[model samples]
Every structure is written in structure tokens, then in C-alpha cells.
Target chain A: MNHLLLLLPLLMPLYGAIFSLFFWRNVELQKVFALQSQVATLVSCILLFMAVEDKGILTTQVGNWPAPYGISLVADMFSCIILLAGSVTGFAVFMFSLQGLDFPRQAYGYYPLMLFLQLGVSGACLAGDLFNMFVWFEVLLICCFVLITLGGSRPQLEGSIKYVTINFLASSFLLAGIGIMYGLVGTLNLAEMALLVRILEGHESLITMAGMFFLVALGVKAAVFPLFFWLPASYHTPPIAISAFLAGLVTKVGVYALVRLFTLIFVLDTELTQLLLSVIAGLTMFIGVVGAAAQTDFRKILSFHIVSQIGYMIMGLAFFTPYAIAGLIFFMVHNILVKTNLFLISGVVARHYNSFALKDLGGVYLKQPFLALLFAISAFSLAGIPPLSGFWGKYMLAKAGLELKAYALVGVSLLVSLLTLFSMTKIWNEVFWKKKPDETEVALLSPITNRMLHMPVVMLVLFILFISLYAEPLVHLAYRAAIQLLDSDIYIRAVLYQ
Target chain B: MRTIILSIAIRLLIPLFLFFSLYILFRGHNHPGGGFIGGLIGSIGFIFHAMVHGPQHTVNTFFRINFYGYQHQPTQSRSIYLMRMMRVNRWRKRKRHYLERRNRNRGLLHIEPIDLIAAGLFVATTSGMLGLFLQEPFMTARWVSFYLPFLGRLGTPLLFDTGVYLLVMGIVLKITFVMAEE
Candidate 1:
């Protein structure tokens, strides 16, 4: 039963991808299969959470091989929370794709690629081995390359070229890092690596170099400051549904990996790596928000903000304390829901006004009050307004920073929050409150776009509201996750000795 | 007429280069030379030949080596061949008309070695590097044995080397075909 719970989420998506590809000619069946598989995966995640709520940690050795020789799937508080968030957001995006899509014939491949990406995300979160994590990251990246280029327009191809090239370079760095680590330590299991790292604490410089390599690679993937040019150039070129999905989850996976590795394997070299991360985080937030301020396009602004929010998550990890790490986890969850919702709402606005440029769109709130309200809620939540999901995340992080006496970082974080609010309001005034453009020609929109756009808005808003109202359990979960991460012995024992 | 001799010289050199590449790939596990270097060497061989003999001749040679029957009697394998033909025809027709109208006074520039080299490097580098990067990152030393008559034991390193070689070759051939039509 334990093993079944471990395999269900992965197998469901794998089967769905295959099913969709084989039955590609039948579009309706493909949608049904994709949605059903996503729901099943989500349900499986919930079940696994319930089953392992009290258990210390769950590990399943795939193919019945020993720890270092075989692939292992792990479930801890951190992975379970990430998996749950991935599934819920993935399901919402799947529904949005079904309804909001305008070019189904060309997008026949999108569903399968999305399922494969989900498989990769789940696998990455659950993987206990270094090589397996690399494999899963590639799986997710390849699918993203395809999805980003699905429309094959000039902008799509250009964006894809940049996206693929940078991601490919990042993968090379990841491979090099893994190879060097394996060559030095003679092991590929992350837990084993953690043990070996502790045993070789005298050789801290080597480990620090390896940590830098992994950080840079994962940083590129997460859209960190210096390596973030590819993100804003490409993220807005994908179909709205793809944009929403990626905006919600992809970079967060990188942050998750960074947190996992630093907290577990490279804990010995924290000061050096953390200091570098702190400086990078500061620059990343400031630069990203400023870029967002300069952007006139709605989606582009949100895309730039993804880079900024990732800075906050990285800042939390840089603090390297239980409270700070817990705050990072909660903040990540909040950002995913709020960011994805904003992108989807932009899609709806685009549908109504036929433009994503802030200069071209206006006065949408006059007609669609529900959408306007949803947009306002998501934007405020993103800005960390009081009693919202983002507020708790920011408050906790600020508190954690204060405890660590990182006064400047806390101040910068607060300043970034105000800037975030300012930009969100800028989007609001341009997109919803201002006067509508005088265009005598109104292009008829499909019913699919109208219905599909609302699902993500409703689903994500409810998620934001739920997290705001019921922050206790989730916050507790985050604290437990942070504690488990800080105490590497539990993770090592679960993966190696269990 | 002199160009034909140069083409023959290049053709002869290709086999020698291929042999050296194979040697490098096999001994790469213990030394510096590996699949990536070997694939580049093999691609360089084909590219040199294409530079002297032209893209059509190069493609013809490729089809002969592979015995990919569709390239010889394209209409017979209509489904896949038709797609290939469509792409080739469209490219040629468009380029021919454009060049005829744009540069009627000057004759067409003969294919240059530098162009082939550029295309070859792009093809060989991307394909060779991507093959290695896409595989198991840390387990390059793990060997899998397969019994064969000539080679006593073949391993993953050799298999990956061969894969890189094929990828480089395919990419060069495809690029040559596309560039020729224009």
C-alpha cells in the first residue's frame, strides 16, 4: 500500500501522456483522459499526505534494488506539500487549457507535454537520488521547450531559442556538478552524499565549489538575477495556459531543489553559499521589480515579477534558519497561487479587450465585475496585503530575518513588498479601472475562452482565500518541513537506512 | 575538372578520418578524447567532401551509404518521401525564382568550404554535446558488455560514441540538403 501510494501520482501522469499521444486524433477523448489523470494524481497526493501524516518519512526503493543502486521515491513533509500544490495548480491549468484554447489542432501536443512535465515535477520532488533528479529536470525542460514553441510563430520560436539555449547550458552545468560530486564522493544518492559530506568536512572548499555549481545551475532554472534574461524574453510567448502553468510551478521546483540540497547535503558550507545567495537575492528582487515597473505589457510585467518573487524564496533559504526556511515554503506556495491566478486573469482580460498591452486595454471592470474582483484579490494577495496568503508569508519571513539580525535584508524585503503593491495597482488601474478603448470592431470570442478563463480565476482565488483563512495547519506543516530539512539526519536515515 | 580530383581526395580522406575518430572514441574512457571529439572528427570528414563535391553529391553519397531506398526512388515511398519532396521543391522553387530576379547578371556562387565548415561545426557541436549532456550524467564509467564477432566486448561508452557519430552525421546531412536548395 505504501509503495502504491508512492507510484500512483507518477504512473497516472505517465499513462495519461501515453494515452493522449496514442489517441491524438480524438481531441475530446484526449481532454477527458488528461483531466481525469490530473484529478487522480491530485487525489493520490492527498491520500499520500493523509497516510504519511504521522509517519516520520516514507521511502520506496523502485525496482526492489538497494538504496544507491536503484531509484528511490521519497515522501516527506516538504515533498508532499510541493506535490499537493503542483497537482492542484496542474489540474486548474488542465481545465483552463480545455476551455481557453483557440488553436486546438495545433495544440494537440500540449496536453501530453503538460502531463509529462507534471510527471517530471512530481519525480523531481520525490526523487532521492541525484541522477534521478537530473533526469526529471530534463524531462520537465524538454516538455517546456515543446510547449513554448507549440504555436511556431516568430516570437514563439525566438523565445524558444533563448529558452532552450539557456536551459541547455544550465543542464550542462548540472551534469558537470553531478559528475564532479560523484567523482569526489563515489555516491549518487543525495542522502549518501550528505553523509559523505559530513565525513569529509575538512575538504569544505571542494564541497563549496560543488554547491556553487549546483546553485548557479538551479539559479538559472529558477530565474535568479544575473541568469534571468531568458525568462522574461520567453515566458510571455507561450499560450496563456502554458504561461499560467509555468508561472505557477516551474521555478518553484528549482527553489525547492536548492533548499533541499543546501539544507541537507551542503549544510557544512552554509556561510559562503548563504552570503552569496543573500547578495544575489537582494539584487534579484530590486532588479526584477524595477523591470516589472518598466514593462507596459501585462503578461510581461507578471513574468518579470516571477523573477522577483523567486528572490524572496532564495532569500529565505539564504537565511538558513528554521523559521526563515518555513517562511520560504509558505511564501513559495502563496506566490504560486497568486502568480498563476494573475496570469490567467490577464488571459481573460486579453480575451475581452484583444490585447495584453496595458496601453491598449482599459475599463474591463465596468462589464465583468467578477473578473475584476478576482484580479484585485490576486493582485493584493501578491502584494502581501493584510489577512491575505502573501501577508502571512512575508510577515513570517520578515520576522525570521529580524531574529537573525539581518536588518538590511528585512528592510529590502519590505521595500520590495511596497514596490510589488505599487506595480499591482498600476496593472489594476490600466487593465480594469480606466476608460475602455474606442474600437468599433469587436472580434467574436469563442465560448471556450469565456468559460475556460473563469475556472483558473475561481480556483486560484479560492485557493488564496483558503490559505488565508486556514493558515495554521499549513504554517505548521511548513515549520515541520523546515525542521526536517534543518535536521538532515532524519532525511539521511529515511533514504539510507529505512 | 580539377575540382573533381579535390573531391576524390576528400572522399579518400573521409575513411581515414573516420578510423581515427573511432580510435579516439574507444580509448576516450581512459584518456581525454571521447564521443564528442570523435563525432566532430567524423562530421569534419563528411563536411570536407561536401565542400568539394557540392551538397547534391554529398546527399547522394549519404543515401547510398544508408541504402535509404526512399531517397533514390522517392515517389515509390510516397508518404514520407512526399513530405521530403514537398520541402525540397518549395525551397528550390522559392530560392531559384528569387535569385533569378535578384541577381540575373551574376552567375550563382559555387558552394564554399567555409560555409560547409560552419554548417558542419554547428551540426557536430550541438549534436555531439547534446548527446552526452542528455544521458546519465555521473555514470559515464559504467560499462555494459555485448558480445560481437569483431569486438570482444562493447560497452555503453562505445554505444554512446556511436550515437553521437550518427547524430552528427544526420544533422550535417540535413543542413546540407536545406542549404543546397537555397
Candidate 2:
């Protein structure tokens, strides 16, 4: 029963995707199934998190093959927390997609694809095998490619080509890394490999090489400093519903992989890894923020912000402290909600003007003050203003950095936060404060869409507020997940030793 | 492209291809051939027919199945909003929607190739769920205790392979139809 509970979150989406696919001819019926499945997946995720909290770590072997041989699905506190957060975002995005995506796109298997993407995400989080995780990544990659290029518009094609090509390269690097790891460890089970890695003592160099491969591979996906050009170029090209979901989860999944690899399998060379991560984190934050500052498009700014905020999470991982990891966990969940909310909010704004350019948008405050309020709540949280989710994550990271005496990276992070605020303010000024641009018309959203769009944003805003008000429980949960992540023995014993 | 000899050959070979494909699919679990290979082989028959008879003719003849008409055609200016004419817009939309829905209600039922993919996914997931019922983890191979005369032990793996077969067939058909469309 407990084993089934561990597998439920991943299976729910699979079931839902299949169920939705059965109604492919009827878009309305598919939508209903898609939403129902999303809610079901979300509920199961909540259930899984609660189960993990109550039972510590839950591991299940697919096909009764047993650990080390069968494909193992394990839900540690970290994966549970991420899964829970991801499902919430998935639900919200699907809701937004209902009215946010164009009809043509909706008719073209959007809901099923979204469900498949969710399945990939949950599978990636819960997968306890290296090859399994890679397969999930491939699932996400294919889904994202189709979703991004669904319309096959000129710009969508251009952006998708870049997105697909870069990610294909990343996938190769991932495959090569997994191949090397399998060669070295003679097994693909992550927990068993963790145990073997410790026993193999002198192969630290080879292990680090494989680890570097992961860093680069996941870095491209994560949109770190040097590999993030495809993000801003492509993210703004797709429909808001699609972009919002991608912005919310895709890169974060990469960061999650990096953190998991470092804490679990690649702990032998902490100093070297820490040094390299800190540098990448610093540059990613600085460059990503600087890029955001230069963007005129609403989605483009948010896209750059995704890269910048990822730096903070990686910085949390680099410190190699439990407190820091806890902070990373909290920060990641916060980022997913706040960032997705901001993108959804941008979707709302873009719908009004039919443009993402800040210059082409204005008078939203005059037209709909409620939406302005919604945008402010998410934007402020994203900028790390006090009393919101982002502030807590940033505060924890800065404090943890100070404790570790890593003043340089801490300072870079602080400066980036300030610049993030600047970009957010720029958006506020141009989009809401200024007069309407003369050339652009205020395209009215349908009443049904108006209701649907606001519903998800308001829902996410409440979530942000809940996180803000009840920071203690989440902080504590993050700490617990951090403890689980740092101790690979717990994972190993649960999987292999039973 | 529709030469007499080639077309006739394709017509004759299609049955042979289909039979061989099913032969491969059933033999796949024990031997080297399985659902994926079987699906590819099965699709080859259609592809060959398409090459000789033209994609349109093959689609009209070979691909026709259950009716699934009444697609919710998007309303004109469905996304546009005008504040001043709000009530008028709503009323007009309501009437237009009713008329269009009724008109489209009588249209032909034509299921597209994408639906097969959905069916494929459904089958694969069902195969995985077979394990859970028996207190096993998902995707666990469950087999019948007794064997039949011609068929070997029946199990979820074979079901899973069939799912793959449908999925591959669907994807190939969809891609071919799309690329071959006017």
C-alpha cells in the first residue's frame, strides 16, 4: 500500500493523459478530463507528500523486479515537495490554458501534451534510476518541442529550432554521461550507484567527469549563465499558456537534477564542485538579471528572471550545508509558484494588448485595477519584497551564505535582487503607469476567458499569500527534505536493503 | 507515380505484409520481433498502398473508421472584446453559437489519426495498471498460469506491446496524412 502511494503521483498523470487522449476528437470532453486529471494529480501529490512526511522515504520497484534491477520509484521528502509544487503549477497552468490558449492550438492535442509533460515531470522527480530520469527528460523534451511549435508560426518555428537543437545537444551530453556512469558503476539505480560510488574511492576523477557532463547537460536545460540564450529568444514566442508552464517548471527540473546529483551521487569532491557551482551561480544571476533589464517584452523579462532566480537555488546547493539546502528547497517551490503566477499574469496583460512588448502595452490599471493588483502581488514576491514567498527564500539564502562566509556570491545575489526589483518596476511603470500606446488597440478578452484567467491568477496569489503567512511549516518541511537529500544512506537502505 | 505493375504488386503484397506483421507481433514477446517491429511491419502495407494509390485514395478507402463529427468551430472574433457593445456582442454570439452548433451537428463523423495515439496511450497505461490489482508495483508482468494450444502464456507485457503497436501505427499515419495533405 505504501509502495503504491509512492507511485501514485507519477501514475495519476499517466492515467489522466491516457484518459484525455481517449477523447481527442472532442476538445471539450478532453478539457474536462484534463482538468479532472490535473486536480487528481494534484491531490495525489499532496497525498504523496503527506505519506512521505509520515513515513520518511517510500520506495517501490516496478514489475516486482526488486531494487538494483527493476526500475525503482522512490519518493523522498525532496521529490515529494517538488512533486507537490509542480502539480499545483500544472493545475494552475491547465486552468489558465483553458481560456488562455487559442482554439486552434487547443484542438491540436494541447491538453494531452500538457498531461504528458506533467507525467514526465513527476516521473523525473520520483525516478530512482539514471536511465529512467533520462527517459523522462526525453518525454518532456518531445512534449515541449511540440507545444512550443504547435502553431508553426514563423517566429515559433525559429525559436523552436533553437530550443530543439540546443536541447538535443543537451540530451546527447546526458546520454553520454549516463553511459559513462553505467560503465563505472555497472548499475543504473541511483541509490545503488550512490552506495557503489562511496566504495569505489579512487575513481573520484572519473566520477567528477561524469558529474561535469550532468552539469553541462542540465545547465542547458536550466538556462544557466552561458547556455541561456535560447530561453529569452524562444519562451516569448509560444502562447502564454504554454510559455507559463514551461517557465514555471522546465528549468527548475534541471536544477532539481543538479542538486540531487551533487547531494546524492557526486559528494566526493565537494570543494571542487562547490567552487565551480558558486562561480556559475554568480554569473548566472548577474547575467540573467542584466539581460532582463534590457528586455522590452513582458514574457522575455520573465524568461530572463527564470534564469536569474535559478542561480539562487544553485547557490543554495553550492554551500553544501543542510540549512542552505533547506533554503534551496523553499526557494525552488517559491520560484515555481511566484514565477508561474507572474507569467500567467503577463498572459493576462498580453491578452489585453495582443503584444508582449512593454512599449506596446499600457492603461491596464485604468481598465482593470484588479488585474494590476494581481500582477503587483506576484511581481513583488518575485522581486523578493518582504512578507512574500520570494523574500523568505532570498532571506534564507543570503543568511546561509553569510554563515558560510561566502560574501562574494552573497553580494552578487543581493545586487541581482535589487536589479530584479528594477526590472519589475520598469514593467510596472511602462505597462500600468504610463498612458496607452496610440497604435495598439485594447483587445477585449471574452467573458468566459476573463473569468477563467483571473481564477488561476487569484488562486496562485492566495497560494503566495499562504506561503508568506505560514512560512514556518514550509521552512521546517524544507529543512526535513534537505536532511533527506544530504543523507543518501536513507535512500540506499530504503531501495536496496528494503 | 501510379504505374500498373507497381500498383498491382502493392495491392497483392499488402495482405502478405499485414499477415507477416501480425505474425511478428505475436512472436515478438518470445523472440526478437515485438510490438514495435510488428507495428512498423503492419504500417508498411498501408504505406505501400498509399504510394501506388495516392494518399487521398488510401485515406478515403483504408483509413475510414468510426464517425466523430461536430468539432466546435471557433466563433468569428471569438477573442475580440468591445466594451461599448458588450450586450450586443453577447447576444450576437449566443445566436451565432446556436446556429453553428446545430449546423455542425449534422456533419460527417470522421475520426483523425491522432485519436489512435490516444488509444495507444490508454492501452499502455492499462497494461501497467494490471500489476497494481495483484498487489504488485506498476508495469509488473502478469501471466496466465495455464497455456493455450497455439498462443503462449498471456500476460500484461503482450498487452503493453499491443499498445506500442497502436501508438507507432497512429504516429506514422498521422505524420503521413499531414505531410500528404493538400
Candidate 3:
């Protein structure tokens, strides 16, 4: 039964991709298949949550292969929370993609690629082996390459070349790191690696080098500070729906992988790695929000914020405590929903105003009051204002940081939160609250395009509200996840000895 | 007079290069020389042939005529050998027709050997890349047994080399195709 739960999310997407490919020309069939797969994945995730509520950790060997020799897929608290969050955002993105565009016929390829990508993400979250994680990352990366270049326009091509090149380099580093780790430990399994590291606790240099390689590789993927230039340059060129989905989920996956691996496999050198991570995290938040403040393009600003928000998640890990890690999980879940919704709302604003540049977009409230309200709510949630999902995540993280006596990081995080609010207000004042532009500006806008766009925005808005209202159950789930993550013995025993 | 001299030079150099490439392909398992280098050499051979005889004449000699007795079975491991031979025959015919048309229209002065070389380079590079993947799971060595001309085991190194050769040849042909359109 536990194995079935682990396999269901992945199988749904794989089956969906196969079914959609056979009916490529039938858009309605494709949409139905995509939606059904997402719903199935979400339902399966809920069931997995229930089963693991008290069990603590579940391990299943994929393909019925025994542990160590066969690939193992393990879901402790951390991965399960991420999988649930990923499914929610993935479902919203699928709905948005269905309704959003005058997508060309060639885009029949998109649904299959999207499903394949989800399969990769699910596999990545559940994978207990390092090489298996790399394989899943490659699968997702290849699909992203196809999706980003789907339209094959000049901008898409240019952006994709950079995207592919940078990511390819990152992949090589990941492969090299895995090779080195394997050479050193003689095992690729995460649980096995963790046990080995603990046994050889004083081998500081080898562990640090491995950790650094991972940091660089995952940093590029996560768009963490200093490696974030590609995010703003390339993310905006994809179609708005694709951009939203990507903006919502992709980087967070990297952060999830980083948290899982560092917490489980490399905890021995925590003092050294966590200090370096804390410094980087502080800079990541500072630099990200500053970049956001400097941007005039709506998507570009949001893209910058992704970099900044990753800082918060890294900070949770840097604190190296269960409560902080729990806060990170909660924060990641909130951010994915809120960010995707905000980007989708930007899509709507672009539809009404003819541009994502602040100079051209104005008075959204005058035209669409409800849209403005929804945007404001999401923006504030992102800013970590009280009574929202974001606030709880920030509160717990700050509390954890203070407990750890990492006062400077706590201060930086607080300041970054305020700056985040300031930028959100700037966007609100420029795009939503300002007076409507003159007749000439109104004439420049496209005709009221696709009312269907509102469906995704509504779905995401309700998701955010649901999390805010039912914070207790989710917070408790996060606490359990955090506990499971810190307790390495459970993971090692399950995957290695089960 | 200049064209004849160029043709003679290419004729002298092409076969030696092709022989060296074959040597590399066969010995790749224990050494660095593999399918990629060998395929590149093969592409160079075709390119030199085009340069010396002129593309039209080369196409007529190599590609234009149908080569009888060539049968391709989709499931057969040795199908690639048949495909290569057919491709060579087609090239010969095309060369022959091209030379005839050029003689009638432009008196041979309009043909360019550099175009042929560029076309060859393109084919060689692409085919080499494709050839690299013919071996399954990539970078893993395997021994394949065949029953043709009695029985023998061929290593993946040879298969990879053949893939490289084909890739190079295909790329060169494609480049020429594009250039001709331009």
C-alpha cells in the first residue's frame, strides 16, 4: 500500500503523457487528460500524507528491486510536503495553460512535456539515490529545454541557448560531484551516504568539497544569489502560463533537493557548511530584493523575488534545527502558490494593459477591482504580512534563527521582508491602484482577451486562502516533516535495512 | 589545367586518409582512435572525391545509379552496411548528372571545391555525434556477434565508429543540400 502511494503520482503523469501523445491533435482530450492526471496526483499525495502521518518514514524500492542494488524511493516528512505543494501548483498551472493562450497547434507537444516534467519532479522528490536524483533532474531539464524553445522565436531561441548552456554546465558539475562522492563513499544511496558520513565524522575536507560542488550545481538550478542572472533574462520570454508554472515550481525543487540532501546526507560538517550557507543566504535575500526594487518590468521583478525568497528557505536550513526546517517547508509551500498566482495575475494585467512594463500598465483596479484585490492579497502574503500563510512561515523561521543566536541573519531576513513589502506596494501603486491611463493608452490595449485566464487565478487564490485558514494542520505536518528530516536514523534504517 | 592539377592532388590524398580512418575505427577499443575520427576521415574522402571530379561528376559516379542486389531488412544488425552502399551509389549518380548539366551550362568554371569541403565537414561532425549514441546506455562496452561471412564478435567500439562515419557523411550531404539551395 505504501509502495502504491509512492508510485501513483509518478504513474498518473506518465500515463497522462502517453494518452495525450496518442491524441495530440485533440486539444480537449489533451486538456482532460492533463487535468485528470493532476487531480489524481493531488489525491494520491493526500493519501500518502495520511499513511505517513504516524509511520514517520516510508521507503519503497522502485521496480521491485531491493535496496542498495535497485533504486529506492523514500518519502519522509520533508519530501511529502514538497510533493503536495508541487502538485497543487502543478494543478493550477495545468488549468492556466488550458485556458490562457492562442497556443499554436505545434504546442501539442507541451502537455506531454509538462507531464514528463512532473514525473521527473515527483521522482526527484522521492528518489533515495543521488544518481537517481541526477537522472530525474536531467529528465526535467530536457523537458524544460523543449518547453522553453517550443515557439522557436528569436527571443525563445536566444534565451534557450543560454538556459541550456548554463544548465548543461551545471549538470556536468552535478555528475562530477556524484562521481567524487561515489568514489569517496562507495555508495550512491543517500541513506547509505549519510550513515557513512556519520561514521567518518572527522573527514572534513572531502565532505566540504562534495558539499561545495552540490551548492554550485543546486545554486544554478535554484537561482540562488550570484548565479541568478539567467532567471530574469530567460524566464520572461516563455509564454505567460509557462512562465508562471516555472516561476512557481522549478527553483523550489532545487531548494527542496538542497535541503533534503544537506539535512540528511551532509549533516556532519553542519557547522562549517551552515555558516557558509548563512552568509550566502543573507546576501541572497539582500541582493534579490534589491534587484527586485530596481526592476520596472513586472515579471522581471517577480523573477528577482524568486531569488530573494530562496534565501528564506536556505536560512531555515542554515538554522539547522527542526523548527526552522519546518518553517522552510511551510514557506516553500506558501511561496509556490502565491508566486504562481501573482505571475498569472500579471498575465491578466498584461492582457488588460498591453504590457508588463510598469510604464504601460496602470489602474488595474479601475478596470478589474476583483483582480486587483486578489493581486493585493497574494502580494501581501508574499511580503509576510500578518494573518497570511507567509507570516507563519516567517515567524517560525525568525524564531528559529533567534534561538540559534544567528541574530544578523534574523535582522537581514526581517529587513528583506520589509523591502519585499515595499516592492509589492510599488507594483500595486503602479499597476493596480493608479488612475486609468488616457484614451490613447486605452486604445493601445488588446480587446478583452480570454476570460478563461481568470479560472487559474481564482484557483490559486483559493489555494492560498485555504492554506491560511487551515494553517494548524499544515503547520503540524511541517513540524513532523522537520522532525523526520533531522532524525537521520529513521531514513537510514528504512532505506538501507528494510 | 589548374582544375586537373587540383583533381590529381585530391586523388592522391583521399584514399590514404580513408585507410587511416578505418585503422582508427578498428583499433578504438584499446586506443583513443574511434568511430568519431574514422567517420570524420570517411567524410573527408567523399569531400575530396567531390572536389577532384567536381560535384556533378562525383554525384553521377557515386550516387545517381541504383545499386542492384542491395536488400535491407529492418531487423538485421548489418542493415547499416547496405544503407551506406546505397547512399554511395546515389551520390555517384547525382554527381554524374550535375557534371553533365554544368558542362552544358557554365563550362565547369562555376563549380567550387571549397563548397564541397564545407559540405563534407558538416556531414562528418553531425554523423560522429549520432554514431556516439548507437551503443545503448552510452559509454558502456559490449561484444556483438554476427553470422555474416562466418561468425565473429564485433565490439561496440566498431559500431560506435561506424555511427560516427555515417553521421559525418549525412551532415556533409545536408550542408551541401543547404548550400545548393542558397
Clashes of each: 0, 3, 32
Tens-digit lDDT string for candidate 3 (A165-196)? 98998889989999989988888889988888
| Interface RMSD values for all candidates | 14.1, 1.4, 15.3
In candidate 3, stretches whose alpha carbon ends up further than 4 angstroms from where it belongs are A105-108, A440-451, B1-182
**Docking quality band of candidate 1, CAPRI definitions:** incorrect
Worst 10 residues of 1 chain A by lDDT: A99-108
Q: What is the Å distance of residue A365 in model 2 from its true position?
A: 2.4
Candidates 2 and 3 compared: the better one by lDDT is 2
Q: Candidate 3, which CAPRI tier?
A: incorrect
Using TM-score as the measure, what is the rank order of every candidate, best first? 2, 1, 3
| DockQ computed for model 3 against the true two-chain complex using alpha carbons | 0.03
Docking class of 2: acceptable
Candidate 1 residue lDDT tens string, A202-309 = 788998889888998999999999999899999999878899999899999999898889898877777888899999898898889989999999999999999999
**TM-score against native, each model:** 0.75, 0.92, 0.74
What's the CA error at residue A457 for candidate 1, in Å? 1.5
Q: Which is the better candidate, 1 or 3, if ranked by lDDT?
A: 1
Lowest-lDDT window of 10 residues in candidate 2 chain A?
A16-25
Of 1 and 2, which scores higher on DockQ?
2
